[model samples]
Target: MTGIFQANRALLFFLTLAVLIALSSVVVVDENEQVVIERLGQPVRVINRFNPTGASGAGVVLKLPFIEQAVHLGRGLKGYSAGAQKVRSADGQDLLVDTDVTYRIIDPVRLVARLGSTAKLDAELASALPAMLGARLGPLSAAAIALPGNGGAAQLLRGDLDARARDLGVQVIDLRIGRVMPGETALQMTYEIMQARHLREVDAISAEQIASARQTRAQVAAQAAAILQDSAGKDPEFYDFFRAMRSYTYVFENPDAKNPPTIVIPPNSSYLRHFNGQ
Candidate 1:
């Protein structure tokens, strides 16, 4: 009975020891997170890291027990709010812009190497927004920067964010501009300046149109005078008859003829010769 009892005790102890070792060497990684194995404070490898064109690494991973530590970082989408930052426009107008960015870890290896964790990355991201916004929006116009729906500045801000986030081992999926506000006094001044510029443009266009109209009228008058002169040179008598006919038609048909004089001439007068056929 004592031998049987000793053998069973030995077997149970061995089984328990094996289970502890197994549990220590194995780590379960989830689909929404990546694990980085660090050996003595140096990153040795990563598991379940983001891959755009390959299978996911989320599952059970074997690690050397007691010698390695796994640092978990979020592989899911994360949002960072840059809040309202102050920047100057191209015209030296100060503006406040609030923006938000969404990103995901694409290269966990690089992320582990640079910041090591998401919390640190978040802090770093918070500090980087001002410079990024200032660089892109500082050269834009006041109206574009101050206005909420400015697409140009939004596009520029996107490009700047993409460039800035490249070294952070993440991909910026979306960017949003929440608000773009300018000071009340500055906004009024900017509007006045813009209005003045537009009015000047309208005045210049109107002046050009008037000058073109006057030039066209002068051309038409010159053309008509040349036609009349040619007609008189070709047939002087016919031209005289035509002029007399035009004068009689105007005196009778022109309701608004200016200060028409009374006529008291004979029926066979020179002015009536064309009509009287004498």
Candidate 2:
């Protein structure tokens, strides 16, 4: 009877231990989500990653208990709202815009290496989307964008944004844009317009500085010409030697040395009189 009781206790202990191990090691990857298994902070493998070829890595996956971590990423398309953004048009018009981006993690390993998690990805797009809008829509006609149906703004943004999204390990599937006015976006646009005016003032100042620089260069060149004339008046032979030295300097110190002059001078040419001690 004592031996039987001991055997039953040992069996129960083994069963409980197995259940605990199973619980720790089991990972469930949903149809809409992908799981990245990491061992000691390094990604080991991705499960249920996006596969258009129909080899979706969904279903139950196992990882080393206590040694590996599982990170969840959406296998399907995920939508990101960039909120209201203010843009400066080519005609110096400030526009308030709202946009939504549809994206999916194309490379899980790269996404993990760069952004770590989807939350980080969201934070990145939140910051980057506005800047992208400024660059893309700024050069386009503001009047057109303000017209009906937002002037196909989504198509324009999606095309370029998708190309840029490749670096972020994401594929931009779609983009939706609308002209937003009279709210937080309007206030932001007001601030941007004021900043633009300030930038124009600064540009005016820069133009004045550039004109002053050109005048200074012209004055210096005139002074140099006077010096050369004075040297010519001193001695005719000395002037010739001096001129030849300057010519030599110009020839040897050519700015376009990569394509240096190819003309060949004869040994007894008049150009070599100074070198010949004449």
Candidate 3:
């Protein structure tokens, strides 16, 4: 029994030693990340330097567990929202705009030196992008900022970003006006005013057309009446005959049958007197 107890104690001691050895080192690099192995907080090895496609040099990357450290650098595109901001237009219109910035760790060394970590980069975006967009876009009128025309607003903003983004170590490939609308409580009022203006224009055009048509109709009718009057005055006999024909048509086609229709005679009674041969 004494020999068995001694053997068990020895086995327990070796198992504890093995567990300690395993805990002394760790590797958390994924296939999409580049691992920087550091000793005493200083970079010693950079694995997967060129490409992030495969798990190259991705084994039990040994390190003194508590003394050594490893940082996995992200190797692809990442994005963050800059949140909504009230940007003013050249015409003093308040526009709430949001921006999304897409950037990548191009130079890991520079990124580590400048930003220290990916979390730091994200934290910096909130403050950085708003200042950039606001400084670039503010003091423009709503029409200019929102680009009331075809695509002028976006072109203007792109030019601004292109000129300035290089200093930030990130390329601003594109920025867009996501949503632009009136940001006041009187939005409905503004809409109604715009509608009223359009409706007034339409009504003015309609009224002008109506007046023009009326003038044309009146002139044509008056001209036709004058022509008929002149022709009738020149030819009295035919005029009298046509007058009698018109009177006959009016009397015969009158719809009311309540009383017998009578053709009132003039003082000379020229139509019937001429027909009677005196």
Candidate 4:
């Protein structure tokens, strides 16, 4: 009975030791993660979602128990918005600029060597990006930066930033200027200038329309005069009679006038002869 008890105790001890070793030696990496194995604080290898064979490294990975340490990092695109920063425009105008960047770690080994950790990387970017933007944008006018789309300063900064970020093992997918707000004084001045320009345009359009209307009125009056002259040439007596009748109607149609106008006229007057049957 004592020998059987000793054998069972030894088996339990060995089983416990084996389980501890297995747990320490195994590393599990997810599909969206990259792991860096370091031996004695020195980087040994990088196991990521994509290997040289194009296979995912998403299962139990073997490492030396108690010797190798694994550091996991997310393998996904990261976005950083560097909120409003004060910058000077080329025209010597002070403005606030907001910016954003999208990037991904292309080489984890290089990233670990240079930046050490994601927090450190973020700090570096926060310091570096605004300085870069200010330097590049400082030579441009407020109007240029405030215009829509990627401005000239932003484009230049994007190229320069991408080049600089390459050293940190990151690929800058996009860099953009989100907003540009001018100072209060500049904003008021710009508004006034725009208003003045719009007023000038409106005045010009009104002047053109008035000139066109005057020309059309002159043309219509000339046409009416020519038609009247043609009718007079065809029959002078009838035209004279029609003229006398029109004058009589104008002088008599006034609501305040009596049956005949108060003005006196000779009985043989050509205007009054229209009322005579002959």
Which is the leading candidate under TM-score?
4
Candidate 2 achieves a global lDDT of 0.81
Compose the digit string of candidate 2's lDDT tens values, residues 1-278: 88898879989899999998889899988988888898998998889888998687688888888899899888888988866587777776666788888898899888887888887887877766776787667776777667655566667778778877787789999888755554455578889999999999999999999999999999999998898788788777788888889888877787666888655889899999988877
Better of 2 and 3 by lDDT: 2
Candidate 1: how large is its RMSD?
Answer: 13.0
Q: Rank the candidates by TM-score, best first.
A: 4, 2, 1, 3
lDDT, model 4: 0.82
Off by over 4 Å in 4: 1-15, 49-55, 183-278
> Which RMSD values do the candidates have, in order?
13.0, 20.0, 9.3, 8.8
Question: Least lDDT summed over 10 consecutive residues: which range in candidate 3?
Answer: 162-171
Candidates' C-alpha lDDT: 0.81, 0.81, 0.66, 0.82
- Candidate 4 per-residue C-alpha lDDT over 217-243 given as tens digits, one digit per residue, 9 for 90 to 100: 999999988977998999887788878
lDDT tens digits, residues 1-278, model 1?
99898879989899999998888899899988889998877889889877766568899999988788888988788998876588788897777778888888887767878887777887877677788777777877877765665646666667677667779887788777787778566789989999999999999999999999999999999998898899999989878887888888777775566865577998877887777775
lDDT of 1: 0.81
Per-candidate TM-scores read 0.56, 0.57, 0.53, 0.59
Off by over 4 Å in 3: 1-7, 26-28, 50-60, 113-116, 148-177, 184-278
